[model samples]
Target: MEKLQNREISGKQKVRSAEVGTDILKALAELSPATSLSNLAEHVQMPASKVHRYLQALIASGFAQQDQVTNHYSLGREALMVGLAALASMDVLKVAAVPLAELRDALNETCFLAIWANKGATVVQLQQAVRAVTLVTQVGSVLPLLSSATGLTFAAYLPEVETAELREYELQADSNHPLADTAKYQQHLQQVRQQGLHAVHGLLMPGVDALSAPVFDAYGRVAAVLTVVGPGTVFDADEAGMAAERLKQTAEAISWRMGYTRP
Candidate 1:
C-alpha cells in the first residue's frame, strides 16, 4: 500500500508540472512584448511562488528572458529560433515568383534575389531579361559587400554590429576601392537607408549598373535583397525615377508577403 501511494504521488507530481509549464507558455504567447511576474501569475491563475519556479526553469532552458531593468519576462532567443526555422521551411521562392516576374517585366531588365548565405549575400534566384545581354552573375555568386547593389542593400538594413563586422572585413579585403573611405562609405549607407534603395554604376563591373532594395522578414530583419541589373546607359540612377519607385514597391510587397508589418 505504501508503494502504491508513492506511485500515485509521483504521477500527480508529473501532471502538475506539465500543467504549470503549459500554462506558462500559453500566458507568454498571449502576452505581447513582456509581462511582470505578478501579472503573469495572475494571468496563468497560479500562485506567484509556483509561477516563479516555472519561470526560472523556462529562463534556464532559453524559452524566456527576464529584463534586468524592468524585471519583466519575455520570449527568448530559442523561441525566435523556432519561429525562424518554421519560416525558413516555407517556399519563399513560390511566394516571390509573381512579384519577381512582374518587376522583371516592368523594368525590362534582369532581376535577381540574394539571400544571406553563410557569411555574405549570395544570389539564389534570377529572372533573365528578354533581350540577350552578357550577364556575369550566376545563381550561386556571393556578391561583394562594397561593390554590388544587392550586397549594399543587406549592409544598409542589417543590425549595426553585424554591419560593422562586414564593413571591417570588406575594408580589409577591398582596401583599394573608393568605399574604403570610412566617412564616404557611412554616408552612402545612410542615403541607402533613407531612400530604402541602393544603386551602383560601374562598381561591380564596367558598364554594368544595378538597383536593389531589401525584403524584410516578420522580425523586421532583412531576409533578402531584390535587384535589377542592366547596362549603365539604360539603368538610370535617378532616385525618383520610375525604375527606383517600381523596385521599392516590389520589395515592399515581397516583405509584406514574408509577414513584415510596418511598426
Candidate 2:
C-alpha cells in the first residue's frame, strides 16, 4: 500500500506516486483547455521530456486530450467523466471546490479543504484571494499537524494514539514554541473536540491567522477540515472570532452535504 504525506508547495512528492498522478491531474485542471506543453513545463519547472512523459501517461489514462490542430492539451473526456463519478465517493475533495470558493469570496481570504494524512494534513483543495499576499500555500500541499489550523483541527479529532504519534513525528521539539509540549496540545485538542472548532493566530506563518472546523462523513468520522486563513492585519481579534464562528458553520454545512448530521 502507498503511504500518504503532506508535501510543501515546491513540487516535492510527499504523497505516493499514485497520488502524484492526481497532482498532475490537478495541475492540468488549473489550466485553460489546450495549454501548450512548453507552458506547462515552465509552470511546473519540470523538463520538457518529463512533461511529455507525464502528458503521455495522462493521455493513455484518458485524463488528458491532445489537440490534433493546436498540439496542446485539454482535459480528457475520461477525466471529466471520473470527476462526475467521484461526486458519489467518500472523498469530499472533489465536492468541496464551489463551497470553498464561496467561502473565500465571502471572507476575502484564502480558504483550504484538507484531509488527514498519517503524519499531517494534506491540502486537497484551496481558494486564493484575488489580492496578492505572501503566504506560500497551494493545493496538493501539506502542512505540519501542529502548525496550522487545518492540521490542528484534524489532529484534535483524531484518536489519542494517532494524535500522539503525529506529535512525536511532526511537532517541533523546542520548548520555546507554543505548541511544543505533548500535554499542552492534548489539552488543546480536548477544547477543539468539545467546541467542534479550532483557531490559531500566527502559527503556520508569523502574522497570519487561521480558523478551521472538521467535516464529517455519514458515519460521523471526520472527513476533512475546512479552513479560512488570513493575515492578522486583515482580521483583528474580534473579527477573527467572528470568522471562526462562520468557519464552524460553513464546515457544518459541508459536513451535511457529505451526509453527516449534527447530533
Candidate 3:
C-alpha cells in the first residue's frame, strides 16, 4: 500500500513536470526569435530560477539554446525539427474531415470543403443537410472566383497574382457582375479577409444562401474553404447569424488543428 502511494505521487510529479516543460517551451516559441531569461520567465509567470532550470533541461535536449554572449534563449535545432516534422505530417483533408461534418450537423445545412486547384476553388468533400436545397456544388465542382462564397473566400485569402488572370476572365465572362469595378472588387475581397468569412445570397445558386470561411495551414496560407448552403430565408447567411458564427468557429478550430495561428 505504501509503494502504491509512492508510485501515484511519482506519476503525478512526472505529469506536472511534463506540463511545465510544455508551457516553458510554448513561451520560448512565442518570445522567439530570441529573448532574455528575465523576459521568458515573466512570460511564463515563473520565477527566473525555476525557469532557468527548465531552460537548462530544454537546452540539453536540443529543444532550446542560450546565447553565450547575450544570455538570450530561443528555440533550438530539435525544436525546429519537431515543428517541421509536425507541419509536414499535417494533411488538410484528414484534419478537416470531422470538423466539416460537425459544422454541417450543428447547423443542419449543407457543408463542403474546397481546395484551390489549378482549376480554382474545387469542392473535394461534402456533408448534406437532411433538407434539400435547390443547388449546392458537388464533389469536384469548380466554383467561380467572383460569385461563390467558397470561391470568394479563396480569392480573399490567396495572393492576387494567383487569381488575377482568373479574375479578369470571370469579369469578362459576366460584365454585369457585382464586383465589376476594380475598386469594388478589391474592397469586397478586403472585407472578406478582414472578417475572415463571407456570405452570399443566391450568388452561388438561386434561392440559396451560402456562408464560407477560410481554413489556413501552418504557413498561414488558405489551405481550404469550408462552406454551408441552404435556402435563403431559413439559412439567413448574415455575417451575424448563427450559421455564420458556427461556420467561422468550425473553420478556426480546423485551422488551429492544422497549426495555423493568427499573428
Task: List the candidates' TM-scores in order.
Answer: 0.65, 0.62, 0.93
| Highest-TM-score candidate | 3
Error of 2 at 49 (Å): 73
lDDT of 1 by residue, 140-241 (tens): 989988888988888888776766777788778868888788788789889999989988888889989889999988778888899998898777756678
Of the candidates shown, which would achieve the greatest lDDT relative to the real structure? Answer: 3
Q: What is the lDDT of candidate 1?
A: 0.85
Candidate ordering by TM-score (highest first): 3, 1, 2
| Alpha-carbon RMSD to native, per candidate | 9.6, 19.3, 1.8
State, as a TM-score between 0 and 1, how close model 1 is to the true structure.
0.65
Task: Please list the residue runs of candidate 2 whose C-alpha ends up more than 4 Å from where it truly belongs after superposition.
Answer: 1-90, 171-176, 236-240
Count backbone clashes in candidate 3: 0
